[model samples]
Target: MISGLGALDALSGPQRFGGATGPLAAAQPSVSASDFSSAVAEAANRTIHTLSQAESVSMTALEGGNVQARDVVDAVMSAEQTLQAAISIRDKIVTAYLEVSRMAI
Candidate 1:
């Protein structure tokens, strides 16, 4: 049930990444560069974890380890979607950096 924008939404909130809770989530909307970097790192880690899980499921299924076909399909789909989101975010960040660099200062 993860939407296309779910990853992006998660990055905006500390709760999703298991960081500080309560009042931290209620803090101001401004985000520092360090926070942005941490978010990117977290997103990459999540994508990597999903891809690894998919691979593990596929391998188990291939080895006749009693893994269900539907489980494999679900894992693969989740990994694919997560990877797509990461790539999209990376592209947007690069595009924004390029745009900023080109601006006359």
Candidate 2:
């Protein structure tokens, strides 16, 4: 049950979060970018792991592998909740960035 904005496991697959490269990596950071990137990558990995687990559970149930309904439901629900929370966090970040960019500096 990962809660809060730190649960950024919504974006799954090969595309990962905070695995910045090229210019992002090349640029100097006022803050410790490595720590932030590592944290984001960790969160993404956790989310991917959870999603894969849920998918496997569902597939097992479909394949009649003696999977329990409760287990499937719990896994699916956890995945869904994680995804929604991550999305919300992403949206907030985007909004905040936009607001900052719009500021008269």
Candidate 3:
């Protein structure tokens, strides 16, 4: 399971032991914006490929007389899962942006 804020802290900053007086420090550099965008794009491409393959599979199943209804259902389910994953990633990106905007700079 995802660890939420704990995971975020681990990724971005140092741990606080008590009443901290400043921003958390980190041992490594933060992820660059270009890297994040590229990663998002790659995920989107995977989703598109999955959706297209699912559609093709469903169509092929329809054309073949021996095709089972379960095959088409599975294709559709796979497409739905890809779409849900893409949406979830997008939501996380948007939420991060909103959080950054809320921070005092």
Candidate 4:
């Protein structure tokens, strides 16, 4: 259900789009290593939060609470998606690290 651009924005922000306003405009925000690290941390926090929410919902449902089946399904699906995204990012990071390590000094 998520769009490609939405996923990209969620992970890297709007910086990848050049942050331009018009065709002739060329101003872009300066990104530092800390900014990238913060973004990654934020993403991890969000994923953890989502997974926790999904776990709570599932527990509530199992306890015969008032939670609707549809809501539980939605939560599970969202958690699955977040997990998949995190796994994909981890794989990419590992691959990049391995590639960099294999380079000649």
Give the alpha-carbon lDDT of every model.
Answer: 0.75, 0.70, 0.62, 0.73
Model 4 TM-score, all chains together? 0.74
Winning candidate number (lDDT): 1
Ranking by lDDT: 1, 4, 2, 3
Question: Model 2: number of clashes?
Answer: 0
Q: Between 3 and 4, whose lDDT is larger?
A: 4
Per-candidate total of colliding backbone pairs:
0, 0, 0, 0
lDDT of 2 at 40: 66
lDDT string for model 4 (1-105, tens) is 421113335434356434545543335545556766776777787788888999999999999999999999999988889888888888998999999999999
Better of 1 and 4 by lDDT: 1
TM-score for candidate 3, residues paired by index: 0.63
Off by over 4 Å in 1: 1-29
Model 3 residue 62 CA deviation in Å: 3.1
Cα misplacement distance, residue 40 of candidate 2 (Å): 1.5
Q: Once superposed on the true structure, which residue ranges of model 2 sit more than 4 Å away at CA?
A: 1-31
Candidate 4: where is the Cα deviation over 4 Å? 1-30
Model 4 Cα RMSD, Å? Answer: 4.6
Give the Cα error of residue 42 in candidate 4, in Å.
0.3
Q: List the lowest-lDDT window of 10 residues for candidate 2.
A: 8-17
